[model samples]
Target chain A: MSKKVLVLGETREGALRNVSFEAIAAAKKISGGGEVVAVLLGESVSDFGNELVAYGADRVITVEHPHLKSYTSDGYGQAFMAVVDQEQPEAIVFGHTAVGKDLSPKIASKLQTGLISDVTDIEGEGDDAVFIRPIYSGKAFEKVKLKEDGVVFVTVRPNNIAPLEREERSGDVSSLSVDITNLRTIIKNVVRKSAEGVDLSEAKVIIAGGRGVKSKEGFEPLQELADLLGGAVGASRGACDADYCDYSLQIGQTGKVVTPDLYIAAGISGAIQHMAGMSNSKVIVAINKDPEANIFKVADYGIVGDLFDVIPLLTEEFKKVM
Target chain B: MNIYVLVKRTFDTEEKLVVSGGQIQEDGAEFIINPYDEYAIEEAITVRDAHGGEVTVVTIGDEEAEKQLRTALAMGADKAVLINTEDDVEEMDQFTAAYILAEYLKDKEADLILAGNVAIDGGSGQVGPRVADLLDINYVTTITSLEIEGETVKIVRDIEGDAEELETSLPLLVTAQQGLNEPRYPSLPGIMKAKKKPLEELELDDLDIDEEDVEAKTETIEVYLPPKKEAGRILEGEIPSQVSELVSLLRSEAKVI
Candidate 1:
């Protein structure tokens, strides 16, 4: 029943993202008391290997290469394949992040294995695992499992799984030298936008707006509330189309899908399109004037008052307690 | 810049999916080009227009998928191909879909390939990268911006809400995220012309793909809806009291804060 699970410890800005630790958590569950190895692939990432140990990785494999400073499917693919060839893990886990989504399928395909992506939950361990992933953009869910014997490859969505509690245990750290060759895609430069605060997808709390937010200035109150709560601000398609916010903040079927712990929909009418993205949130609070608004249907709590009045009061109240 | 845009007809995101006996009942569901794929269709047209090339929209589905492929043609794709698998293939995972697509495209010498970041209905996002892997090429997913000059390319990829810019080259596959380009609706004239465009049809035999060889590696064991939530507890009173009550509910009842 036990197995060796390999988790790719993904990083951004020289440190592992929260999802990396979450992946380790998932690996522990899927490993079924077997070895859980975390592979940190980057230019110089030995410092973060111990952090993985505290987070429950039984061992850490650091695959360093100069070409890996920037991520290309080809560069990372070759490097990761080398680690896989060496480790030959029974299962592989990755965070359903941008880098994970891009690299996972490529590797799974090369291994001729089935990949259950964006898995929100897992029911079993090893080959017997049943992976639950949202389909129809969160309108429905499906339970899928591998049909034949192969590597159990999966990608876990962010904020869905809790990372393990850190322990003082030290894990064995090893180094791997990969033969990097025939680089196809090259990174001329990486222009990072949206560095203002926490990432919207990984943020524990979110303040989302809609058309009722009215003007660009309307988002100011929401942003202030987000800052106060230590959350990120999101927008409905209506708000983005109205030019009140950027499309990057759009949350809908055509936009980013998020599953934060606390989601606050302010001045927003719950269009089905918008709900497709955020309906999976743990707790939703809809602050809108329309009592009949569809958002109230899904919200755990509702305040049927003008958001302009309610939002500032909510921010003030939270400031008192938080 | 010979381009291939992989398209799929998906259930409209707004429709409530009705699953019966482990299958989605599609009787009354509205079907459209997966909205994300529209960006790929639009970007392909833009790239083809800028550089002298042809854009071919390809899809694998039943005859019902022709409607979506025609829409792609009306949006300026040079041609359309529907690999009807209603007769041969059933119960597919990503591997099967990617294998068939790669088989058909093996000899095409395609310069650029485009797909949506994820299909709304399946939401797996594996086919694009899998096909690229089978074809032994490079790929970037969830791209917001793409600039191609000669053989070199520049892309701004969406990493969650943030962006990462990278440069790649030809024979590359890129999946479209939103904000790549506003997908244009089919003009009436364009729609009329699409009626006359070349729409080719193929089957498993044509691509030399055996159903067993490209069989799915995963199986769907269950299809069900999330449990319906109880009607929300609405707090009524003055703004100040309502805010306070909500905060207390979050703390005492939900405990999310």
Candidate 2:
């Protein structure tokens, strides 16, 4: 059977999330010369039909309803379930965002199939898809194979894969509707925080800190450096526990997993938890006073000094170039 | 209102894990309730204390899981439920576990469901959200802070680099992360009282879920030690020569420059 890859696109406040396009680009690679279907469920599909094709989706399977405007588990799941049942795609891919995180497992359960969630890598392997997931709080890597015969599910972590653009290519756009009267949960409203710049998960450059950052005042330098490079800031679990920063900024086993192009660790001792989150970055740079710190193990570049000094210099140099 | 806090007995993360024959060796290691889940239990118990609700601690594991269950009860949960699943649970994927738990909560009067954002063991982080999906309940994850204000739940989750706050009604599902609340230790009296509290044990059928419903999409193919690290060479010299040597290493050998 020819491969048909289905991507579960995500939306934020009634618009397609960037990760949705990134997922479609990834699914197209796994298509192996088969069709690419982007499954979209929301209140309105009229506005997103054209953008879906620009991101390499051969076909757009849109499921729209008034109740589906906000994110309700039942409404969205039912819509995707109907689409999957109607068209038995070989594999389904999703970007592991909040909506995708909530929707993928339910779809897997309804289908009585298996899913590889939060996958960072995927490759086609002889009639089956091989998925790479972090196990043991990112201490280990597990390569999983979806054993089911048809319609396997895999949710890749956002920003891990680069998005691609395609021109002069398009496919069918179909609509789907399902009964959601029995849904148990409802999203009454979706409130968003108006923040500028890329999400940490999507940033190509990252500047992270740890407990060694002394005090809350120490974070300003890192922020200054991040701003200079148009990057995001991350924290270690210890720093979060110390209240030097919010837990949301913490990057560790219990926190967000990010894979950026350039990752700079400042003052972090590189605990296993912290490593689990950002170890997958393309290039790693560590700045710490402790020469014996474990962060140097995986760091492509290491500076055995104070971040307060090194960061300002680096930021200034980068500013001069940009 | 009844609150359910899910707990899992896992290997102590502080200890170095040894994988023998593709299974985690826990013969000599200590076990405890997942650290993150401790926050969930603490938050649930706090909610119960303030609102006059019953807090039920639930787990799906072997009889050994009872120790953690007892610990939670000792910490002041009103009751405990153990789905004795060790024999049949080779590796119950998140989907199967969520389906089973959702069915178990079907007729129960639960106003809130609390789970750790992710178990350190499986590290899938999909269970809580999947359970909310199966139950069709509003789900919020990575909640760093939570406040209950008379039938409403306000949550603060970390998004990108900022804190994103959400407001939802009762009878919802939430996954707790660190900083949500500090888990409390069991008082001497509370520990003693836990022995008298009821710990209900149920079979798989009690959850109204079949064993075959959940299929494992991913399995541990193998577990082996990571690659060895190269010893660092001590560069002892004047600053200029050391910098020159480092530059040489980067340019010629490492080629990372």
DockQ of each candidate relative to the true complex: 0.81, 0.32
TM-score for each predicted model, relative to the true structure: 0.97, 0.86
> In model 1, what lDDT does residue A37 have?
93
RMSD to truth, every model: 1.4, 3.8
Candidate 1 yields a Cα-based lDDT of: 0.90
User: Cα deviation of B112 in candidate 1 (Å)?
Assistant: 1.1
Judging by TM-score against the true structure, name the best candidate.
Answer: 1
Instruction: Name the best candidate (by lDDT).
Output: 1
**lDDT against true structure, model 2:** 0.75
TM-score of 1: 0.97
Model 2 TM-score, all chains together: 0.86
Q: What is the lDDT of residue B77 in candidate 2?
A: 93
- Which lDDT tens digits does candidate 1 get at residues A129-220? 78898988888899998898889899999999899998999889999988888887766655555537588888889999999999999998
